[model samples]
Target chain A: MATIKDVAKLAGVSASTASRALHDSNMISEATKERVRKAMAELDYSPNYAAQNLVNRKTNTVGIVLPVRENQDSLGNNPFFMQIIQGISSICSENDYMVSLATGRSNEELQKNVQTLIRSGNIDKLIFLYSKKGDPIFDYVKQQKVSCVVVGQAYDALTDHIQYVDNNNFQAGYDAAVFLGQKGYHNIVYAYTDLEELVQAERYEGYQSYIKQQGLRDHHLGLSRVDNRANLEKLQSFLAKNPEIEAFIACDDIQAIRLQRLFKEADIANNRYALLGFNNSLITEIANPSLTSVDIFPQELGEEAANLLLKKILQESQTLIIPHQIIERESTASIK
Target chain B: MATIKDVAKLAGVSASTASRALHDSNMISEATKERVRKAMAELDYSPNYAAQNLVNRKTNTVGIVLPVRENQDSLGNNPFFMQIIQGISSICSENDYMVSLATGRSNEELQKNVQTLIRSGNIDKLIFLYSKKGDPIFDYVKQQKVSCVVVGQAYDALTDHIQYVDNNNFQAGYDAAVFLGQKGYHNIVYAYTDLEELVQAERYEGYQSYIKQQGLRDHHLGLSRVDNRANLEKLQSFLAKNPEIEAFIACDDIQAIRLQRLFKEADIANNRYALLGFNNSLITEIANPSLTSVDIFPQELGEEAANLLLKKILQESQTLIIPHQIIERESTASIK
Candidate 1:
């Protein structure tokens, strides 16, 4: 209800001087800034981010688009997203910025939302959680040449560079397999999801590479795609077929928890088949016997992503990796 | 960057006609509305929420103040808030709106952010998650006659005109005691948060009332103060002094889980102690023997809160109460 003129009158300064002090623009004296700040606080003066964005071409709001399909694949019930978001939010809130969420079903819908935000001049920066090859979302980002940072890999088809942070899933998978081998569990299996997603594929490859490295190239690889009912059944079938398989490594913790349920149904004794899970979500700790899990530091990953985006927005131009810790709990104990 | 004029030109209509069609103004026909919609899809037109908001004096953005304290309430460990937020987002997204998070050390900072958004004219509604006696955050809502739906209750001094969706904490506490009593437990203890929080105090009353009704009015009560450490120590002291207190009811799952850990350290087996927890959060399920807890449906509560806020925003004015469910897990068992 109060205007800049009222604030200036209350602060005993010219309207132009008050405006400059409020904006902290060039040439505003510190004394004037303090006077203006106190007056603004008294009057509850709030700046319109949208109007300011129109004038100065900055919104100071980041758009986070989480595209949830029919299944909400890789997302629904995943604690990982929450931690990453907390990380991003913690930094954003500290820096006096706000986060907005957008959802889409189809590529067309995703493109519509992104384009609408750009054309309507709502958010200046966008952070996408999911990435795809030849994504239409990327097409518009490239055309507008707006700032963006993605959690997943961007397509090589576009020349627009994006800052990203990802765990070394391949290396993690390799290390899990190698550790099991050193523990004398030769017939190890990799329980995975999708098998199409880049992260899953990389981990699968890592398991294969590690097996070859350990001269156990004859190992049987077990595949169980999560979300598919048949995949849950395949886990049970795999157990029935492979008595020699003493250790199993899951691509992620959710899948590992599911397998633990099946193992209980089979009445399999603990350590009869060692289990290792990834991402170290609460599921690992909740599994009846607890679970050995790879800690991806999702919270740190989220923080790094936010910092990366902020750096890019500020033109600092930095990129880096976040380390992972292997938390050995009850699930991956040595087989007697 | 296509405007209504471009859409009108492409559709062979006047600019005024396009505007009427987009707004569904009576001046336009249904056929024209369909044509304009198709054109909008092709050109990716997004009816500017801000411009509309400025004209109508309502942005439809709801502020959810988290009350993240200076000490930071260790909420990072649980997935409860995350699920609630996602549920809130789902409803907001469906109604074409955005949810912004607000957290501050003191109520002054909280009021500052709210005032900022209020002045920016960016949000038309508020949903305060945490409320304390004489809370400054609720002061703005009352002083400004703002349309707000608080998630929890504030001080009795605060105006009661503002709507809220608070859990029946008193009922939850009564049910915990009743359930434990039915199981043949004689000396049950009540463990909870600070009495300064009106909701927790209600729960304590519920426990006391239930015990009085059962003719066991001398039950032990342990109040876990604000800091988790303080609560832990209080719980430790309760265990040290009361050996006859064979059963305990924790106000929340987090507290119950911590109590279980303490019991383990004390060489007292869980289920041996008959622990019951409120808010069937992930921690309860993940704890040893799985905690028996009351499912408050935090996500559903969030959805309910958002629905109520939007209803008030649209002048629909309907107040509702969402129920709590009791989940009987392994933390407590029947003595019979």
Candidate 2:
């Protein structure tokens, strides 16, 4: 007889995700759930829902802990977190689970809200919509021994106990550089929103590693603030310094589109440079040449995070790595 | 010895919103709440919390009902609703109220979810993020006599009962046309996403009214679908058919950005056409010439909607018209 472990192995996911998928939990994505179902069918495995329900005693509600940024209004400014929330909502809707946002303007307020949510039995599991160093929330969750998942690259030192879902950003960055190279761009400028963001740093390292391997020249650019003034000045300086730069690999699509606009204003011919970005957002499609970008599939990441957290709640814990893809558009279609 | 109704009038909100604001309810925005408090103080009135609490029987939580669209993934695709959500979140956070989202892929599912949310006591009041005629959800809410507020213009028939918050889109559209005319663009194209959207229809009417009054030629264009193929084809046809068209008054910023891209690809010179849009989104900031657009103040609308809903919940209701502002940029700076 094929056991649940065999099915999990076939699906290539954590035993927890596989178990949640089999139970049609709201935390798993349709794609992951379909894969688990296919694996179960092949292995002839059937889960006992009645017995699992008796053991579960689940609240069917998940708490989303949004990050507290310096600006305090980051949620309204960045579409990244909103996209993740949509993804989480999709999966939760399917599984008949409710996702409530628990956020505050400051760390103290956020900690208080989280503690209250957990103590009051409002949420069965918690999903941190961000991963960063010195996040006090993580320590509190750990101390409380609460079931939780972080939706970004996990902290290296705490990887053993913390469950997380993240894209292989390093590989994604390396692949972006390789794509640019294949299009005959030798001098590449790496543009980033912030060096402190975990994904940006990882992607930047991967980009550096790729350029070094290919013996290509590197031009680093930073958009350290959302104010746009610093970013615009940096762009002008970079262009003045590196007139021979053939392509730009922005950390994300928003900045890439902004760069495209700046390039136009600075009288840089569109045909002279290829712009590649991450997070193939709507902005990419609306760009003049339609920007080429890496698709990190935030929806899938949200699904995986929710799934991992649910599994942890059920005493089935595991980390998951979501995959990414590169989308080719007119921005990188032709060499100058 | 002033009444709550007087405070509502002074605050330029409905009676329910005024009451909620005075009570420090979660459904009122900070701005409106402050205004209501000021109005109360000026009127030399102090509310009795015990009596109001007994009369209100408030749960202090509000439900946000998102529209079901033909494209079920509209929530992820459009930043419009996301902005409104952020606005609602800000106000709800200030008032110490929990905001819960109720959405479904179809009308039936949406109605069912709304009913369940209300019946189960997960939400105390409701706010609809979008409004159009013949929304079954509206009918259901009315039948159940559920307290609610719509974020856009209320339907003519339902105006008596339904409270709402909307911009003066008509005057805004007329102003946009007049602005383009001042820039020496006589032949103007009035563009829209879909005629069915309430805002689109109102803005289009405003555009028509402006052209007719000025005795200038008016060209009508529609992006019937967001798929881009039909939109691109329509753009090509519009350009070829009306070579005399000098300026475009797009219904919203997203469509305006898309039109700019389409024009660029179709071999239209950047300076040949004056482009103006509504809702000064980030896309406006990143456009080649930085798009000229109307600032609808979505955050304020969200705040107003929450305020109205709380008022409706407390049986103190009235319609509110939030104002709009025009922001000029390089896109319509001068005619070539």
Candidate 3:
């Protein structure tokens, strides 16, 4: 809470001299600078960054823009976002950059808050948690020439301008099918939610390519738009018709966990089907029998996004693809 | 991105007049105010709040101070913290206040960041997620006379000035024991972590009180400082010594989930021991038999904290205790 006057008085210098010394102006002599530094340190003075930002136009902070969730009740409750924040915060801490989160119950509100944050010059860069088409915030950031990076896969056409960090989701999907096929599972289903999500689409495409190349069949079960109970019933009927299905490639770990719970409720034997999930999140480990999942390395994705955004802020440009690995666990392991 | 000049030109007034109109100064006539409002709306001009804050000294933002974690890798990865944030964000959104997180890898770094944040005047209120003893940030906030509300139980003497929101943890603990005792599980264990944590301490006190009143023996297990494997081995050994123990009251859901996993790995039959956990978090649902946990209503806790902080900021003071409930699930259901 020490002011410039206090530092000046403590150092036996004028307020202007103290200010100059703090700002490292050439007008302040080395002795005066040393005295002012000692005085400020003694007083525990913290330079007001907001006041400095008015002249520098930089806040040394990154603004994290969260995607407007479909489930408003679960806002900030998603483990995926929590992991991304952990990655982002770790990197930001290392770089001495502060982080501020921008969220809203709706997209319009989210966009408005983002605009306010940007216009107020509270952040030097923006790291978006998702990259969806026709997003106003994305369009605004692009039009305003702001330094930004998206954590999800970007559209093919937009990738040239919008840099992003993501995993090879398509290859991950293909590998899931190949892994199951090698495990002696012939009929495999690609089960997922949020069919409109680009990651899900790409993963599904990978599943399609793999099934075709291997002379296998493809069955898509969409659960994104439906409620959990409805999705469970739909899954049950599908399994009844296609009892030959020996394995399923789920889009993410939560869905895979849900599928496992449903299987248990339906009295389906554990060895009857193998389930492969993505994200290798904690849920996979907590799920009974555990879960075999593709470790998309979400934290790495977040770290990559932060690194890319920092690069963009420094006038550098780069796109990054975080690697993914399959973690074979009880869900896909041979039952003893 | 629109400027005051643009609004002035569109409203047929000078920039000064436009600014006054925007500020709603009494010197500006109603007619001019109406014109400026229309121009601002037409151009989608947002007044710079940061500049206004320099005068009004309010940021309409809350600074959420997290406990400095020893586990640097899992920063912001705690699901319990995530749920609290969900609650905080929901209430903040409802009140049109922004949420910013302040955390660091070390206590010193955390204090520095908090000081900078406070000195920069970027937040009007601070909400601490924990109230452990000898917390430098807590001491600083108290010394600075800053508006704050703790989310956990504070020491009895400090509660006079520090408004807090918490459950009756003693009752919650007592209720856990009584719930198990009522179900014919006479010999029960109170399992917890971080006895230093006030919540855990209060819960343990409640458990002790219950055991004394019921004339049943009390056994305590501490796992906070130990690694999971070590804790599991210790638990296995404890169970070996006390095979008559019929139930466990884990301090939280994550611990409960871990206990369930350990029991399964150790080949302990589920029906042999009942388990009860706190927080009714997602892990409970994902656990094999589905855990029965105490629902402390984390979202409501967050809402209450925000409400209390707002009231304190507005010159009101009141301590609040949010209600807790027991959620019965397969983990505590009658043995089949």
Which candidate leads in DockQ?
3
In Å, residue B265's CA in model 2 sits off its true spot by 2.4
TM-score of 1: 0.77
Candidates' C-alpha lDDT: 0.69, 0.75, 0.78
Residue pairs with colliding backbones in model 2 are B16-B311, B16-B316, B17-B311
Q: What is the interface RMSD of candidate 3, in Å?
A: 2.9
Write one digit per residue (lDDT tens) for candidate 2, span B74-148. Answer: 566566676777667667766656666777767877776676556533455788887777788887787764677
Count the clashes in each prediction: 0, 3, 0
Please report how far candidate 2 places residue A225 from its true position, in Å.
Answer: 5.9
Clashing pairs in 3: none
Candidate 2 lDDT score at position B234:
82
Q: What share of the true interface contacts does each candidate keep?
A: 0.20, 0.19, 0.30
What's the true lDDT of residue A217 in model 1? 42
> Of the candidates shown, which would achieve the greatest lDDT relative to the real structure?
3
Tell me the deviation in Å of residue B24 in model 3: 7.3
| Leading candidate by TM-score | 3
